[model samples]
Target: MKKAVLILSIICMIFIFVQSWFLSLGGSYFDFATMFQGGIVGKILALLFIAGGIAIMFKPQVAMVVYFLGGAAGVLASMFIEYQDLFLWGIVALVLGLMSYLFNREEKEGKPGSNL
Candidate 1:
């Protein structure tokens, strides 16, 4: 479960970052802009998700909340933006966050001295 979350999180971060880069003024790929389309809002949210993804390696539960929130923000951001896999990745992020949350909870509870 952790591995799955880690891989997906990395993919999400990279996709967001790369897409953002390709859309920036310095970039020239007009076709790529439609892939994610969130403007500055998307970029900021992407940074948040990136930070959450990195933090998850050390702290699963807390980072997962951040991850989930980032996903939700993406979904909300979609109201104004367009495309971006038709918001498919946002839902994926939500599911990934939920899975990690539940998995970490179970792992913590199953431990010898866990109180959960």
Candidate 2:
């Protein structure tokens, strides 16, 4: 489960980065500018997500906060922007974020009897 979340995070981050870059280059392949409210903000969000992905790979506990916030922000942003596609991705991110948080919590608490 942890592996799956990690993979999903990485994939999502890559997609965000590429999409942002495309927007930066004046490419409207995904209409992210309209979805994000502007090209600059979209690029910034992508950069932040890239950072969040790196944090998830290294410090997952800390990254959990980022994931939750990002997920919520993505959902809200999508809705307000009226972008159905982003809303779906937002849902995906939210689920992956929750899974990652749960996996990290389990790791921290450890399995029963493991101390023995």
Candidate 3:
């Protein structure tokens, strides 16, 4: 489960980075102005996702917080930019964040052997 979450985080971050890059390059599928203007926020969000993914590797607890915050930001940014795809990424980030929190909690509680 931890591995799955980690992989998902990495993949999502990569997608976000690529999307940000595309937007920065003036590539648009629907609304160009929205994407271009939102690209700055998108770049920041991408960095957060990348940081969260890296943190997940060394510190699951910290990564949990990062993911949660990043997810919330992603959702809000998506709404502001009127981009639907970012909402999905936000959902994924939230789920993975919750999973990481649960796993960390379990480890702290000493309920299991702790794979994370």
Tens-digit lDDT track of model 3 for 16-103:
7777777756735555777775666667767777777777777888889988987897788888884556777777778878887987
Best by TM-score: 3
Which regions in candidate 1 have their CA more than 4 angstroms from the true location? 26-37, 83-86
Ranking by lDDT: 3, 1, 2
Could you tell me every candidate's TM-score relative to the true structure?
0.73, 0.66, 0.78
User: What is candidate 3's TM-score against the reference?
Assistant: 0.78
- lDDT by residue (1-116, candidate 2, tens digit) is 65566667778767766665555565365545564453444444455555556677677776677667666767777666534445555676667667768777777678787556
lDDT of 1 by residue, 1-116 (tens): 66667777778877876666555533334544533355554576667666666666777887778778877877877775653541565676687778768878888888998893
List the RMSD of every prediction in angstroms: 3.8, 4.3, 4.1
lDDT of 3 at 75: 87
- Judge candidate 2 at residue 86 and give its lDDT: 51
Question: Any idea how many clashes model 3 has?
Answer: 0
Q: Whole-model lDDT for model 2 versus the true structure?
A: 0.62
